[model samples]
Target: MEKKLTKDDLKEIENQLSCPSGSKGIEVAVSMNVKNISMTKASIDLLKIANNDVILEIGHGNCGHLEYLLNQAANIHYIGLEISKTMNQEAILNSNSLGTSMNTSFELYDGEKLPFENNSIDKIFTVNTIYFWKNPNVFLQEISRVLKKNGVCILTFAQKKFMQTLPFVNTKFKLYSTEDIILLVNNTPFSITDTIHKKENIKSKAGDDVDREYTITILKQ
Candidate 1:
């Protein structure tokens, strides 16, 4: 039988999920890459990438899907921004291992402001990272500012109800529903172009079989 998690264990999981670090953080990131692959692919599809497009992904833990994303189009450049140093290094290492180092780059940030100029990026996306945004409203503006006119930003996250069931999602995590996110977007500069709710049968991080409910919110400036 699997060992039960203690209070400290759950808290550690929550912290690593937010901004991974150390050896435990590395392990957690690898697990996250597996768990979030489907969500990542779905978000990538919504981006509608084209030839020579500049793509940005926030909180790209280890970026194990970089090859799949690069194969979407010709001559694409991918930039991964992360708050976790471990994740930043791991992504670069993984990209190198995949022989995709030339076309990809990874950087660490404060998770508050994006380190790019206005109207710089062609497409932006983030999966399961919305819950950690220090200020969604202001950060949405940053996303808008960095994106060129008519740029697409796909935000994917599990619904509040589903996320609440996770043992590791503690007070540090801010869960949201479809309605809550829609309302939040309404207050931003970008307009919601599409909202997709999806469910999948998968094994949870805690090693339990369950149904996962998530949403993909597409935004345009």
Candidate 2:
């Protein structure tokens, strides 16, 4: 039997999920890598990655899938951005260890503003990061600003209904339904080219089996 987590324990889990740090954060990063791999792989496949494509991934925790993304194409340059210093450093270490350092770069960001120049990136994708966006509208415009014309952006997140069931989600997470996200995207510079609905049976943070319903919204300018 497992001990129950207190409110403080849940809060710590929430904080770590938002911006991991310290030794515990490193552990969280690893856990996230394992839990998020399916969504990450789906997002990458939606990218339809091509040769020499410059790809950007937001909130790439530990980026355990960097080698997988690099394997999708030839001459692909992958850039991972995170608000957590621990994730940034851990991703670098993981990339080096995977021998994917040559084609990948990691950076820390303020989470509101992207670091690349306008029209610079060929493809972009983010998994489970939209809930933390300070301003989803402004951030969508920033994504449009950096993404090249016709560039694809894959946004994946579990729906509000599913996310709300999690004990640690709390007020820190701004949950959304599929309708909510489509409406938000309509106001941005990009158009919703595709929305893929996904479901998986995964263990919850507190260690229980649950059905997770998520979405992969593909955006293009």
Candidate 3:
């Protein structure tokens, strides 16, 4: 018999979705692995990475995408900032396994401030990480600070309506419509270059395949 999702299971899913710390056990790991595949591909597709660009990924859980990106580009440097120590360690190990450690690095961040210097990064991207940002403006400012002039930032998240369908996405997850995100970015130094909408099939908490709508917002600083 298949196990049904309980309140505890939902809560664990919520925690993993917000910030995957790898402590919730195998179920969370399985969910995150599925999410990583789709979200990483979506974010990377928007990047259009160049051979020598210095790219950064915020809240990169497991850094699987980083390994892929590093392998795709010959001379590009990739940096990852993650808040979860377990995920950070896992990402490091994954990079080592890919033999891309020289081109990739991972660091633990508080999600409020970035460790990069001003105008240091050529490109940046994140997937499913905006909801957990306590102060969006501060984080946006930090992103603007670290990004070089005319650099690009791609942020990917599920649309509000689709996000609302998830029982686990409660008050803890700050759901946003495309308009809301555009308005928020308008207040910053960045301007929206493009927005891509995609529908993907993913597993629900009940282990059922469901369609989810995600939006990738491309911004230029």
User: What is candidate 2's TM-score against the reference?
Assistant: 0.99
lDDT of all the models against the reference?
0.92, 0.93, 0.83
Worst 10-residue stretch by lDDT in candidate 3? 22-31
Rank by lDDT (best first)? 2, 1, 3
The residue-level lDDT of candidate 2 at 23 comes to 98
- Candidate 1, 130-167: lDDT as tens digits: 89998999999899999999789999999999999989
Candidate 2 residue-wise lDDT, 97-212, digit = tens = 98888899999999999999999999999999998999999999999999999899999999999999899999789999989998899899999988999899998877778999
- For residue 172, model 2's alpha carbon misses the true position, in angstroms, by 0.9
> Candidate 1: minimum summed lDDT over ten consecutive residues — where?
201-210
True-vs-predicted CA distance for residue 3, candidate 1, Å: 0.9
Which candidate number would show the highest TM-score if scored against the true structure? 2
* CA RMSD, predictions in order: 0.8, 0.7, 1.6
TM-score of each: 0.98, 0.99, 0.94
lDDT of candidate 1? Answer: 0.92
lDDT tens digits, residue span 53-126, model 3: 99998887776566567766669999989888878888888889888888888899888999989999999998
Better of 1 and 3 by lDDT: 1
